[model samples]
Target: MPKLTIVAFDGTKFELDVASGSTVMENAVKNSVPGVEAECGGACACATCHVYIDDSWSEKVGAPDVMEEDMLDFAYEQKPTSRLSCQVKMTDDLDGLVVHVPERQA
Candidate 1:
């Protein structure tokens, strides 16, 4: 399992043990972490699972796909580092990963 550090816009942080092959959105949603709505489940249909990849771990997570890239444009507070958490699958290289949630999602 990989450990994920999720931080809210207000500075709240949650450390979750995520299973390999599961999406980051799954871990956040299952643990009731605030700011990750995951409204469309893990299907990538919604941008509620938006997150900002920590600069240090950005290279490990890589860039988002075309679909994910397009969807991010719809997220609140879109940024150069914005990504949909549902699209980020957990992996060994992502151990101790940190992501920041945005202020809003609709």
Candidate 2:
């Protein structure tokens, strides 16, 4: 299993131990981490799962796909590092990954 550290914009953080091969959105929603609505249930159709990868972990996560990239344009407070959590699959190498949720999702 790998652990993920999710931080809210207000500085709140929650660390979750998730199984490998699960999506970040799945872990966040399962753990009830704040700000990860996952409105489309990891379908990549909605950008409610938008989050910012921490600078230290950004390179590890890499970029979003074309569909995810297009949906992010509809997210609130979008940034260059913005990514849809549902698009991020957890891997062994992602242990201790850190992501920040924005204040608003819609």
Candidate 3:
């Protein structure tokens, strides 16, 4: 398992021990992390699960694919590190990964 940190808009942080094969959205929703609505249930059909990858982990987290990029256009306050949590699968290499939820979803 790897550690995942999700920072809410109010600066609250939810620290979780995540299974490598699970998606960020899955863990966030399962743990009741604030701000990760996951309205589309990890289907990538919406932007409610939007988050900003911490600058330090951006390189390893990598870029969003074409579909995710398109959906992000609807996210609130999107940024350079913006990504859809549903599309970010957990992995050992991403241990200690951190992401920031926006003030609001799309």
**TM-score top scorer:** 3
Per-residue lDDT tens digits for candidate 1, residues 21-44, read 988899889888888999899888
| Worst 10-residue lDDT window, candidate 1 | 72-81
| Per-residue lDDT of model 3, residues 41-62, tens digit only | 9999999999999999999999
Model 2 residue 64 lDDT? 83
lDDT of 1 at 70: 83
Can you tell me which runs of candidate 3 are displaced by over 4 Å?
none
C-alpha RMSD of each candidate structure in angstroms: 0.9, 0.9, 0.7
lDDT of each prediction vs. the true structure? 0.90, 0.91, 0.94
Pitting candidate 1 against candidate 2, the one with the higher lDDT is 2
Top lDDT hit: 3
Clashing residue pairs, backbone N/CA/C < 3 A, model 1: none
- What are the models' TM-scores? 0.95, 0.95, 0.97
Candidate 2 segments exceeding 4 Å error: none
Q: Compared with the true structure, what per-residue lDDT tens digits does model 2 show for residues 15-58?
A: 88889999889988988888899999999998899999988988
- Select the stronger candidate by TM-score from 2 and 3: 3
